[model samples]
Target: MRADPKGVLTGDHYLDGDQACAEGALAAGCRFFAGYPITPSTEIAERFAERIPEAAGVFVQMEDELASMAAVLGAAWGGKKAMTVTSGPGFSLMMENIGLGVMMEVPCVVANVQRGGPSTGLPTLPGQADMMQARWGSHGDYEIIALSPNSPQECFDLVIEAFNLSEQYRVPVMFMMDECVGHLTEKVSIPRPESIEIVDRKWYRGRKENYLPYAVNGDLVPAMVKAGDGYRFHATGLTHDERGYPSTTWQTQEKCVHRLVNKIRQNAENIIKVEKDNVDDADVLVVSYGISSRVAVPAIQQARQQGIRVGHLRLITVWPFPEKMIRELAGRVKAFVMPEINYGQMVFEVERCAAGKAETYLVPHGGGWVHDPKNILQVIEAAAA
Candidate 1:
């Protein structure tokens, strides 16, 4: 099988989610990766390290997750599509740099192959507990795009989407993969480079002297410039003006932070995605993402056989929480049954969107493994009742 000039394999092959994710990044033109080895996510870094040389890309095993995240941001400014991968404790360690990435409007990707966690929980197992952390872990009021992939095939497909979204929005997109999907082997079809669409960062093209680092056009996202490219620009995590200088005042903060939040919030409809099945006439809707979505399939089928009108809503983009769809469905459905590996993270979002219009049931699992189909079925049965 012939790969493209950049060394992306262009054929169908069996792969695990981690390896597929690595290929997806390469196909999407990710030329730099900086990451620390962490459980369930190390394979992604390993695969990228092994294959990146063929693409003339760079891979660095950093001292820790914080340095890994920092290096990713630095690489992005150096005119490279960059990413980093980690899980649980490592994810927590990278929070500060993640906030810096947001404040500086850096375009990059962070993949968290989630394992069971409060601290150093289950290293080799699956968990969906990081859903909320993906949104709020950075310690500020900013917006982010997050994608969850349920299978190895999706792991290949969605990482490309994650990189595209990051470039388009100038935000670090979070790829939330649970350990179950990360380790699951399946057939992944890698399309040719010509067929796959890649979104490069909107680089500033006008006169170098006239460039303002944070100046935006019609879209709230500003155009970028490569570092040391004969362009003088300052980018800081502090509240700054369009020139990217520190101007610590409430006014500057409002203008700086507001656009950061609004850029994604206002365009959420264009950015958010979900998979809906049989929702038009269903009495109960099964809301899930990641491995839980795959596990919920059997329970959904069982409910259908038992004559319950149950539909499934699988979250493809978890953050910017698909509020409008949930609110619309809540008006019609009797209740929403959410089965996530976490105790009750995304279920809260469902409940908030439902807004007391319908009941919300949580089939909570404390991680380590996926939910039992029987447990999910019982919740669906009760929600239908």
Candidate 2:
């Protein structure tokens, strides 16, 4: 699908990750952005507020995070590509409605520019602590698509991918970025509108009288209709049947929620993206994502200089967690070392997926900053030993 030319900022420019992200959303055909102002991530909303008008869309400064999340979900069902941006505290407030979006199968993007802490930690600082929260914060059994961008260029590039995936899967896709990446500056080139491919929302083309909001027609993803498309459809946070009315019976519950989980699970391989280097004969692998992956490069290079056969695997998609790839590598490598700004959030995932085939080590940081390459280097050396 071609992007609307008016919204696509097609050219090369030096931009920060947050600004690049906003351009990405615009190019991806996002017509509505609803968010509350918050540090590190506030730039994303500011940019959207300034730019979305060109596309004949709206940017709303919601009363709070809860309202922002709800508004995004509402806009989505109204047939607009919608999104919201926030930091940790706001991310927490957005959780309930995130589940609502999931239950209603609303297609939207939630970009959480991660900062330090469980509460109001260092708002201006970077942290990868929210990696786990992005997956399991919302209540109930469901699955989500999440992407992590390691640089400003990718920040611009991946937001388009995030929106495309959300439309394809009919779920709230998380664009997880750390404070470092959010604020970091780099050159970004947005392609021409016709050059950018998009996955437009799957609108129901069947008879209006037979519209079923939650019915999966063979592909495990239901077609959608706008609120005023002359189709009466129901949607809610409650467990729902194909008609989207609340359903509490075991059969309805099993059928509805199970499809939600399986749609992403069955398509896991296609959704997962990773970058690997030097694994053919490496004895140890260094795993990281988001900003940490950039910070980890020096450490891996140093390990190679020191005659250690170390490889690197940078996760571009954090959810679905790439269990199959990690599991495969575990059988060949001696150990896996993960360095993140959190104490050990993603390391737990690595350990679980490794499943005893290889030793897993976590080089934990308590946030506020990126990992020192030397710290990761020492761990890599030890893992090689």
Candidate 3:
């Protein structure tokens, strides 16, 4: 229960992934959170409410997911590290504002502790179905950084990385945790404040007269300023120029949107992360993320024991979707096997990256549960064959 002056818990303790996510956000200098209560994801908002005050932070239980996202965007412009949590339907409700956050280039975090379904599928159970939604949920063209955590420890560690990426790229970073990871309790070691690395938003520090909200240098990311800092800047969802004025021309859209997409795309190599085991020389590569990644381990081991040369590739950074690594591996591996809670989401990305160079197999689950290791192993065997 002890925390440093900045409210970072500085010791090891038993915590669920949701709770660890809250602590990680605080440690990463997130001083504001606005979220509505939703199943599986509510514990994150609850933990943040209890702990944020100690960190000299603010927490708001917004009327719904839409306002929650709006408040987070506002808080970020007000010069606070801000975030929100949601699940399933709540996640769908927040998509419009999530797009607004992207168009405005607001630096904030949105955590979707995914549950099952297109609607109210499974409130109490886990699903990794939101993989595509987190990327393409919002309207129009834009890029985002998303991280998938396979364990409670990763929930703590990766959420901090999520915030750092959001700040560094001046974009909304999505922390994609499933119900299994969000509710699973495990030992999470909270590092000291000194040891925790935090990235602050790149603020506009020049003379107020020279401020242009959407202006950028070579990095494609523009500097941000606090809303009340006497900087006259306008932000909107419509296409805008460097001055932040709404412009409907194709040329303006090209300039504005291209940078929005390229800021992450061009720098994706640095932002993407994956955990690899025996990938260099393997006949079959098993690719998974979140809870499915952990569940696939046993199947991979079993396959190895049965004389199958299997490699495990666990995605840590799901979005900016590790195309280069997958492409390279596709050239070497004989086949690829992907297991996810959804019918088939990220597996399509794997298939695209594999580009028919290697055969791809999917182990799909409807929801409410994880794939049986035996089922996964069978697929591994098939892919190897």
Over all chains combined, what TM-score does candidate 3 have? Answer: 0.98
Which of the predicted structures, 1 or 3, would earn the higher lDDT when compared with the native? 1
Residue 331, model 1: Cα distance from true site in angstroms: 0.4
Clashes per model (N, Cα, C within 3 A) = 0, 0, 0
Quantify all predictions' global Cα lDDT against the true fold: 0.93, 0.92, 0.92
Tens digit per residue, CA lDDT, model 1, 147-255: 9999999998899999999999999999999999999999999888878888877999999989999998779999999998999999999999999999999999999
Model 1 ranges with Cα > 4 A deviation:
1-4
TM-score of 2: 0.99
Candidate 3 structure quality by residue, lDDT tens digits, 1-385: 1223476888998999999999898888888999999999999989999999888889988899999999999999999989999998999999999999999999999999999897999999999999999998999999999999988899988988998899999999999999999999999998888777777778888999999888888899999999887899999999999899999999999998899999999999999899999998799999999999999999999999999999999999999999999999999999999999988999999999999999999999999999999999999998888
Which candidate leads the pack in lDDT?
A: 1
TM-score against native, each model: 0.98, 0.99, 0.98
Model 2 lDDT tens row, 1-385:
7888988998998999999999999999899999999999999999889988888999999899999999999999899999999999999999999999988889999999999988999999999888888998998999988999999999988999999999999989999999999999999999999999999999899898888888776889999999977899888888889888988889999998899999899999999999999988889999989999999999999899999999999999998789999999999999999999988988898999999999999999999999899999999988888
Model 2 CA lDDT for position 103: 85
TM-score of candidate 1 relative to the true fold: 0.98
